[model samples]
Target: MVAYHSSALDGVAANPALPTPLLLRLIAFDGGGHGPPFQALHRPGLPEPAVAAVLTHPVLNARVQFAMSGQADAEQRARLANDSSPRVRAAVAYGPEWTHDHRTKVRPLPDAVCARLLEDPEPSVRSALLDSRHLAPSFLASLVRHPDPAARHAALRVWDELTPDGRTALLDDADPEVRRSAALCACPHDARLTAALLRDSAALPEALSHGLLRRADAERFLAEGVHLVELAGNPSLPADLVDRLAVHPDDSVRLAVSLRPELTEARRAAIDFTVAPHAQEHVGWVAAGIADQGVLRRAATSTHPLLRRAAARSPHLPPDLLRHLAADTDVVVRTNLAVHHPDTPEEVLMSVYARLGGTFSAWMATGHPHFPREGLAARFADHPDGIYRQLAVRDPAAGPDLIERLSHDPDVWTRQAATRDPRLPLPRLLEALALPELASSAGANPALPAGEMAVVMDEAGVPA
Candidate 1:
């Protein structure tokens, strides 16, 4: 068996591709209250056999059912919504965001189940329902005036899209805190109200960060000097104000200005902004969502390195533009292309990893689906940097002896990576599992024989 390096070495329970029969056995094992044993059931496209095991297993724990709640089919979801355990019910109400593998996006529960959850007898379940992103507009409207202030606050997630009547109700809410939140939520869409709220010193910072700011207001804040950072980040700041802030004395403010999407390459380069070694707050490209071809084309060709980097982050960039960014002069741009672009070429990902392999963010490039494995061992096994040597274990062509040698390497990460390699001998793999530091990754190595897995499960008090 070969290691699937595309997935992280999280643990056995998190491995989405575990065989269906094994998954069924895991479902039958009671996890007590611990999470891992049952978590695998959350994987997308969970087999019908595994789902049946979770639902029918006589000894299945409530936590087991809780973990599978989100990915449950429509009929199963309805059953879970009325589950005997409140915790299980709450799990369904929360609407888990992603399937266990992080591949499939989980959809909202059926409308009927959502309606029942809205009025669930347990306040915990009801509270969980409010946190769900899938709630309908009408449900949110009903929640905005809920007697519980927390419920009303939770409903404000949809405040920007709330109906006029809903907004009015929240504006006049009995709770002063609720009223304050309502004002902030309405500020972007209600220019007159934003203008009025600007006069209040307490509301000024958040207002400048996201609320619409007129030229006069920006100038006044500039003179005041306290909110310059927020002013630079404000999407609605006027063009002239944006230009003025680009040259502002504060480095943070200038950095923020440099990231504004409206600035041309020349304007951005003139700012003398410093790109921090690590990422700071997300820039305009992130907020703008998926950009159009025209926007991406301009960003890719921009003289400003950060603009090119921003374009690299666009997953939908055309093939030519993707290649352009892959070969970009800036390492950051190329790295971003490797990490974010779905179609980044194999060579680009390898190059980025070879350069940044020791860096914390390098995993993103190495773990990319397109990363090459054919010659990795031969290329990096003798490299001076242990980080590069660590990658040799990922090479499918590497032999058992090489895997064993690396498993004993002095570099902790190298040892860890080697331990996860399926090529490691059975005795060595079991030895790695005995070591607390390496056990998790060792268990995650899909190469472990099924008979051995059953024995391991039995030792954990989970008999097949």
Candidate 2:
């Protein structure tokens, strides 16, 4: 008797071109290293063999079957489909010639083969089937019933093409992923299904529930007045859903109700009540659709600092409102007014500088594009804060005279700032440097000199 082992058969089965008859003979020989049990062997480079020889050799037959599957020959593929080994038969199942019609033509795969392969023993085979562009709906539906999450996931991925009954079967699927996928695919086609999914408090998992709520909210907010009114009239809407949507953090929702063409005055008031104060500005801006001073005034007076600041910077603020905010207590409001208020009077601007000190003064002293340079120069020169003096010295309006004046000011920061002033002439600058009391007072000290020091004058460019 031949004495080959299972391991030798595996080696031959793995080699596509290995002869099966020799492999079987080796298996019969208990894996002895000698040649085939049958001594008559075809050598290499032979022409096509008889069909009998090909069928008798398992390894050669598998190779022939694999080759026939690759060919356009349908008869050869059909003949190989009945091969005894599941491995060979499985190759035929995957072969290109095995169309949807061939599912029954091939030898019946074992239930375990279908079950084990439901997840696909091979990832390439599974993934190819999962992603098959041309898979028929009937074939896909059958695969969907396979007891594997992976196969179900694949079927759910293509669920859009399934019949209504097929899609309905997946609704109660054990896998939440499958249900969620179906929900997403179904939402666009069937409003009743979407509403049912959304309304089924327990049907949706938390993540999908939140996603659906947000999506529905967004869609409702964007819908026309007629549709929104229709949805609002639906008695089925949960009270919590209504309240949550009414007080929704989105400004657009409030604005939608506020500006709805069909809204009664009472409804408008209710929307105003539901919207947070901060969200009102968006409603007002959209309602006006143009710059309106009344809106600006209301926003400026709002208790919300953000609204107040926004109003202070609004292009829609009237000239009078700009004038009023020029002296606002909040430096940000005043600064925004200073920067944006085209009609801000020079006196109001000066008051803004005087009242809003530090960076605000510095901001004003650096000439605003619309403000007169002479007024800004005067403010910078006469600014009570010494920093503004430094600003003045740096100003183009500051000639040699102003530089001379600032260079000897008791405030060291002002003096130091003056020293770097581009407008300070070399003669006045040199004279200022010669004054020991002015230049020798630790010129680099960050602290400004106290107001009590002598004011050094150098009209003739004299060292003090």
Tens-place lDDT per residue, model 1, 1-464, is 11221112235555444667766666666555342354465555667776666655554354435434566564555566776777777877876555432324465566667778877889989888877766666566667777878678766877767778878988889997787778898887667767777877778777778887777888888888877888888878888778788788889889888777777677777888777544534556643644688878877888766667777787889988887888776878888787777788997887788788877447777777888888989988888889789879888899999999998888888988888788899899888866777776777777776665655555565545
Global lDDT of each model?
Answer: 0.72, 0.46
The Cα error of candidate 1 at residue 336, in Å, is 3.2
The estimated TM-scores of all candidates read 0.76, 0.31
Q: After superposition, how far is residue 123 of candidate 1 from its true place, in Å?
A: 3.0
Candidate with best lDDT: 1
Q: How many clashes show up per model? A: 0, 16
Cα miss at 371, model 2 (Å)? Answer: 5.2
Error of 1 at 120 (Å): 2.2
RMSD (CA, Å), candidate 1 to true, equals 5.6
TM-score for predicted model 2 compared with the true structure:
0.31
lDDT of 2 by residue, 246-319 (tens): 55455554444344323334544565333343232333342343266656665565544444566766656766
RMSD of 2: 30.7
355: Cα error in model 1, Å: 4.9
